[model samples]
Target: MARLRDLAKLIRTKNAGPFLLTLDIMFPDRRTYDRVVASGVIKKESMARFFSVDESKVRLFNYEPANAIKVTVPRLVTSGDPADTDLFGGQQFGPLVNVEVPDLPAA
Candidate 1:
């Protein structure tokens, strides 16, 4: 029942563009990376719910070389729009910091 933050080396968010926000979940090593990806712990459905975005619009990428997962989604509002709150998107990653990760059954 370990949390995602405890296993991830880095989980951060940033602005990909005026209309997109990007999230990065990096693992410290391959073992940890495999655990999250193989277990289906970080699926688009779950992520969509977490971010309040449409599943079809969410883009998830796993980079083996970096042992990292990247998620890109349209921002709630265009950057610098009247409704925009976080211009830098730097503080948006906090919600992912304590997400509980379910343990995969013995494989």
Candidate 2:
């Protein structure tokens, strides 16, 4: 398996709004990005499940030029809410760091 942690040079998250967060998965190069995309492991539905967010609230965007995927989802709790743990969602990308994506089997 080629885990996302291996293919991605960086995976990070930040506050998109008081109620939303943005995640960026950056690949080292276009080859790696293509491989990850072909692997079919990082779909929007999967991310919705992984992040415990409703699929309707998740948006996945691929930036081919940047070789990155940008995802936006509602924050687990509104940013700066009384119960919110992270104001900036700075640590939210941690869950994606170790996610595994199986590589295509050699023919």
Candidate 3:
């Protein structure tokens, strides 16, 4: 097995807006992208669990051309709210980095 952090070229999170956070899973090549997408480990339900949001509130966009998957969820705390620890939502991607994925064949 391989961790998502190993398979993906870049995994990051940021504020889509004051009320939403976006996670970007970018793969280095088409082979890696295809493997990750087919793995089915990265989906709305999984993302919802990772961010602790309702499944219906997670929006996933697979941008094939860019070899990237984008997931957006409602922020647990509004940006700049007193309870918000990550003002830019940058620190919210921890859960996704360790997500397990089937190993890729050697290049």
The number of the candidate with the highest TM-score is 3
TM-score of 3: 0.94
| Candidate 2 or 1, higher lDDT | 1
By lDDT, the best candidate is: 3
Clashing residue pairs for model 1: none
lDDT of each: 0.88, 0.87, 0.92
The deviation in Å at residue 46 for candidate 3 is 0.4
* Model 1, position 51: C-alpha lDDT score: 81
lDDT of 2 by residue, 27-72 (tens): 9899889888888777889889988999999999989999999999
TM-score against truth, every candidate: 0.92, 0.92, 0.94
Model 1 lDDT per residue over 4-101, tens place: 99999899899998988999999999988988898777889888888899999999999999999999988888889888889988788897877777
> Cα deviation in Å at residue 27, candidate 1?
0.6
